[model samples]
Target: MKAILFEAPGSDPIFTDVELAKPQSSEVEVTITAAGVCHSDLHVVSGDWDIATPVVLGHEGSGIVSALGPGVTDLSIGDHVVLSWVPSCGTCRYCLAGRPAQCSLVASVVAPLGVLHDGTSRLSKDGRTLHHYLGVSSFAERVVVPVSGAIRVRMDAPLDVLALVGCAVATGVGAVTKTANVQPGSTVAVIGCGGVGLSCVQGARLAGVSRIIAVDIMPEKLELALRLGATDAIDSSSTDAVAALTEMVPEGLDYVFDAIGKISTTEQAIAALGLGGSAVIVGLPPTGQHARFDPLALAEADQRILGSNYGSVVPQRDIPWLVDLYLSGDLDLDSLVSARRPLSEAPAALVDLAAGHALRHLLVPSI
Candidate 1:
């Protein structure tokens, strides 16, 4: 199978023919149908993460089960599924406690691709091995993944759109629905309007927020936000975002989401919150970078700061629900896909994504 391999930072991933392993007991082999090129993957290829070199980077994806391991019974060949980067071992303390997203077993497997509880990789290439990023390496045509990492869903669900469930959409919607627990009639502001940010805007809309303010430096993004569900748009580049949003609401917003993982945006989100309002940080900034905050301001405002990962999404619970959302016309997945191309063109898609023109791009990994 042909897969995208990141050789090093700033280098275009080389598409190479690689041998794929069969499913081991408790694992499943999937034929990746569509994969989304995400900022997270960019962060990986750009060396923004501590991931091992020559790793297969994509996480957000949808696929069909090609084979299932000996012990796997929950899913089988022909079952369509969405891939999750964070694969949880149900026996872990977190999983047992009903917080599968926070499963410790997943934390242990995240960094290295040629890893699992077994300490070996199912992925490898030309004598060398490949590591999995977030358990499911959707960038490849087929992936040998743990059963815990793949969520079985309706085969009829539009495979291309469902690909977003693996990452960007899940993170954005999950942050609003699970992390912030958005309240109806609440006033919400979202900074950044990429895939995740746009989903946050839609989440706010779905929650029935009274006011939805979208903020970003790009006019095009803000425009897209409005079409998605934003009640108002702010060009932070030309305007003082804090001042403008504050002027519009006076008391600030009930919820503020910083979808861009930068200290400045995080600070702005914190400053734009109303009393008792919560600020959700949804972006993946460089690891270890800290944001300075005024202790008195946080204290006096009774505001809260929350971190969201994968939208606090429990794949089994959320992916199906999102499919239903798409079914009911409650969610817009088709619009999120700005372009589609063959896997060989994925590197160029990455370039376009880096140039900042799309919300999400899908790679036909197997076509």
Candidate 2:
């Protein structure tokens, strides 16, 4: 199979042919249909997070099941599915508690080891083992994922759009509906209108928020946010985002989401919150970076700061709902797809993503 291998940090990935091992007993092999070039992938490629090198780099994707290993009875060949990077062990403490997003098995083992739950690589090239990125390396023509990570969806759902639901959509919408639980008629502001931020705008609109404020340094993104669902937009590059947000909502916003994964935007989200309002940190900033907040103000105002991982999503529960919303013409998945290119163009797509030149660039491996 052809895959993009991240040979080292702060370097471009090498596109080359690799060997894929067959699925294990509980795994499923999928022929990649479409994969979204996500910011998280860019972060890894840029060395923001110290991930293991010689790994396949991708997570958000949709595909058709090509084969199933022994014991994989729920899915079969030809089943269309969306891949979840964070696959859960159902018996783990977190999974049992309905917080599968924080499954300890994945956090303690699979992530650090960069392998399957069984602690082995399923990909290799020239006799060298390649690490898996978040257990769903979809930047290739095919991938072997744990059955638990594959959520079956309707075939009618566009694979390119479904690709976004695997990460960006799930994270953004889940943050609003599950983590912050923004109430109807409330005021909300989302900083950084990237893929995740735009989805947050759409989520807020779906939740019936009276005012949805979109903040970003990019005017094009702000305009796109308005088209998605934002009631107002702010050019944070030219205007002070915090001041503009404060002036827009003197009492503070009911909910604020920082989707850029930066300390500055996190602080902005915190400062813009109303009394008793919650600030949801949706972005994954580089490791070791921290945001300072006013302890006294938080105590007096009863404000809350919450960290949302993967939008606190349960893939099986949320992906279908999002699909329904998309089918109903409520969720705008089509607009999120800024461009589509073949697998060979993935390297350049990653560059454009890092340069902030594209939104949800979907790599159609079959193209």
Candidate 3:
């Protein structure tokens, strides 16, 4: 298998050939078909997120179930599945409470994967152990992922289009539909016109939002946001976002989704809230990062600041429904794919992702 090795933070990923291993009793080995180059992977690759070195970095992906481990009867060989960053344990306080993303089992398993779990990973180069990223390191030809991290989808769904569903799409849509509970005809303003932000725009549209406003620094991205369903676009690089939106909606929007995960954006989302408006946080700021807002305004206006992780998605149910939406006229997955290339061209995709040029760059490994 050829995998992207994270040598250190702020360094380019090193692609290398490695060994292969069978699936564990609770795991499945997937033959990687399509992997989306997401900003989250860049966050790890940039070493902003603390993780052990020599790890494979990628989470949003979908592929065929090449093999299954013992006790894995729910899935069969050749089933198409989408990989989620969240690894859920069916028997947990959170999982039992219907919050799988908050499943406490993740921290327990992260250490092993970081140091090549299983005492020996199928990944290695020159006899050196390589760590795995996010439990589903989709940046390779194949990866061993826990069953909890996969959501089986219809095999017929276009794999390339659904790649965004793994992360960006799921997060964006989840923020609107699940986290914010966006009501039909609600006014929305999404900060950040990236993949996830654009998905939020589309999700708001699906929820029948009347005024979908997009804010971003990139002109091209703002254009993409309009195409994705944004009724209005604002280039924050020049104009004052808060002031501009204030002019549009004097009392503020019903929902403001801060997909950038920045302290400043959080503050803006909070300040721009309507009398009973809510602001949902979606970006992954580095660990320990914090944001500040006015307590007086929150109390006076009945405002709320919420944080959404993985779009509060139950992948098994959500991914399939999203697939159906794409099949129908609801969700447009094909439009999210800005470009596609073979797995060998993954490095270039990462570079382009860093440049903020595309929604998602899909990697067809078997291509």
Candidate 4:
């Protein structure tokens, strides 16, 4: 099968033929229909985040179950599924508390090694082992993932668009509905207007927030935000985002989400909050990146800064709900998929994503 491999940071992604190992215990083999080109993968390619070398580079995708390993009973062949980067052990403390996103096994072992739960990869090229990305490695035509990582969704939902629900949609929308739990009639601002940021806009709308302020440097994204649900838009390229937000809401916003995950956006989200509002950090910054804020201000204002990882979502529970939302015409997922290209064109898709030329690009294995 064909797959894209990232050998190291600052190097071009290689689209090469690779051999896939069969599914092992509690694992399933999925024939990937569509893979989302996301910033998280770009971070690894750009050296913003470090990971194991010689790995497949996609984490968000949708596919059909082609084979199931021994001991797997919840899924079957031909089932449609959405892949999750964070696959949890249901017996873990975090999973028992309804916080599967913080699964201890994935954090301690799977992530650091870029392997599956068994601590081994299923991809190789010319007998040279290749690591998996976030345990999904959906960049390939097929992937072997643990059952916990593949959430079965409705067959009616288009597998291509459903791919976004795995990452950008799940993270952005989940941050609003799950992490911050923003109440209706609240004022909100989402900084950055990429795939995740735009999804944040939609999430706020779905939550029935009164004032939705969409912030971004790109004019196209700001326009898209308005169409999705943003009541107002701010272009940070020519105008100061924080100042514009302040002018729009003099008393500060009820909630502010920094979906860009930059130091500047984090500080801005904190500064733009109301007396008791929360600043939800939804985007993932490079490892070791830090943001500085005033402790006195937070204490005086009774504000909060929350770190939302993967929107604090339980994949099995949330991914299907998102699919239902899309199928029912309430969520606008089609708008998020700006383009679709063949898996071999993943390198160019990464370039367009990094340049902010697209919202969400899908890499279809068949295309």
Candidate 5:
């Protein structure tokens, strides 16, 4: 199968052919239809994250189940599914506690080694093992994912659109609705206008927030945010984002989201909150980085600083609901798809994404 091989950090991904092994007893083979070129992929490629080399780099994807493993009885061949990076073992402590995103096996095993729960590589090139990225390396034409990572969705759902829901949509919208729990008619501001950030704006709208403020350094992105559902937009490159937001909501916003994952933005999200407000950090910053905040202010004002991973989402429950929203014409998945290109163009697409030139670029393998 053809795959994008990231030989190492600080180098461009090379388009090459790879060998895929059959699915294990707990896994399923998927013929990938579409993969989203997300910033998280770029983070790995750019060495922002300490990921292993000679790996297939992508996580957000939608595809059809090509083959089912021995123990995989719930899914059948030809089932359309959206892939999620966080695959949970149902019996784990976190899973039993209703937080599958923090599944012990996924966090402690699969992610660090870039392998399956069994700690083995399913991909190879020229007789050498190639690592998997996040257990669902969607950059390849086909992938062997654990059954838990593949969430079955409507077969009629557009694969390209569902591809975004796997990550960006799930993370962005989940951050607002599930994590922050923004109340209706509340004021909210989202920092960063990338795909995830824009989805936060849309999520706030869906939650019936009256004042949805979008902040970014790019003017074009701010305009796109308005079209999606932002009631106000601010270009942080020209003006002070914190000061501007403070002026808009004199008592500060009821809720704020930091989708950029920068130390600065994380701080701003907390500082721009009103009394009893919550600031949810949705972006994944590079490992080992930390943000500083005033504990006195948090206690005195009854404010909260929360961390949301994968939008604190439960894939099986949320993906279908988001699909319904799309089918009903409430969630605008079409506008979020800025460009679509073949698998060969993925390298360039990553460049454009890092340059802030594209919204949600889908790499269509079949096309």
Candidate 6:
């Protein structure tokens, strides 16, 4: 099958042929329908996050199940599913506590090795074993993932559109509703109007936030944020984002989300918080990157700096509900999709994404 391979950091990802092995026990093989291009994959390509290579590089996707492995009785062939990178073990402490995103196997093994739960690649190229990205590796025509990673959503929902719910939507919406738990009538600010950031805006709106402030350097993105749910927009290109946000919310924001994942935006999110407010770090900065903040201020004001991974989502519990929201029109997921391209155009799509050319691009294999 064809897949996009990132052989090394700081190099262009290649669209190439790869051999996919059959699914193992407690795993399932999904024929790729649509995969969402996300910044996390870019992080790997850009060398921001180091990983084993000759790796398939995509995590956010949706597809139809074609095969199921042993012990995977919960799902069956032909189920339309959304992929979750963090496929937690149900019996683990984290999963039992309703925190599957921080699953022990994912944290210590699957992620670092770029393989499935058993720590082996299901893909290979030219006699060399290829690594999986976040265990999903949905960039390919098909992927073999752990049963827990393939989340079954309603078959009626469009698989292409549902792809975003895998990552961007899950992370963004999860940060507000799950991680921060922003109360209705609270004020919120989200930096960066990309897929994740825009999702944050939508999540804030769904939480019934009184003021949803969206900040970004792009005018088009800011406009989109307003249309999504943001009550106010700040073009960081022409103005200071922090100063503008301060002017709009004199008392400071109840929750400030740094969806850009840069140290600067992370600091801005922290600085823009009100007393007892929380700064949700929803974006993933490059590995080894660090931010500086005033510890004294946080202590005095009773503020918090929360790191939200995968929006702290339990895919089994949350993905279905998100799909229902989309199907009911309560969630404007249709607006989030900017364009769709064939799987072969993934390299160019990544270039466009890095240039901030679109909101969310779907690489449809059948297209």
Model 3 regions lying over 4 Å from their true place: 111-122
Indicate the residue-level lDDT of 270 in model 5: 92
Task: Please list the C-alpha lDDT of all candidates, in the order they appear.
Answer: 0.86, 0.92, 0.83, 0.93, 0.92, 0.92
TM-score for candidate 1, residues paired by index? 0.97
The C-alpha TM-scores of every prediction are 0.97, 0.99, 0.95, 0.99, 0.98, 0.98
lDDT of 2 by residue, 178-232 (tens): 9988899999999999999999999999999999999998889989999999999
lDDT of 4 by residue, 83-124 (tens): 999988778899899899999989987787988998888988
- Candidate 4 TM-score, true structure as reference: 0.99
Residue lDDT tens for model 1, 1-367: 8888887776778888877788888999989889999998887876777777677768889889999889898997999999888788888888888778888877876545447546677777888887777777788889888898889988778887899978888899999999999989999999999999999998898999999999998899998899999999999989999999999999889999999998899999998888888989999898788997777888888989999978888888998898889888999888788988889887888888888887799999655
lDDT of 2 at 152: 94
> Candidate 4: lDDT of 205?
97
How well does model 6 score by local distance difference test?
0.92
List, residue by residue over 1-367, the lDDT tens digit for candidate 6: 9999888876789888999999999999999999999888888888888788878989999999999888889998999999999988788899898899999998888899888888888899889999998889999899999999999999888889999999999999999999999999999999998999999999999999999999999999999999998999998988988899999988898999999999999999999999999999999999998899999999999999999999988899999999998888878888888899999898888888899878889999998
Candidate 3 TM-score to native:
0.95
Candidate 6 TM-score versus the reference = 0.98
- Superposition error at 60 for model 6 (Å): 0.4
* Superposed Cα deviation of residue 89, candidate 2 (Å): 0.9
Q: Model 2: clashing residue pairs?
A: none
Worst-scoring 10-residue span by lDDT in model 1: 109-118
- At residue 204, candidate 2 shows an lDDT of 98
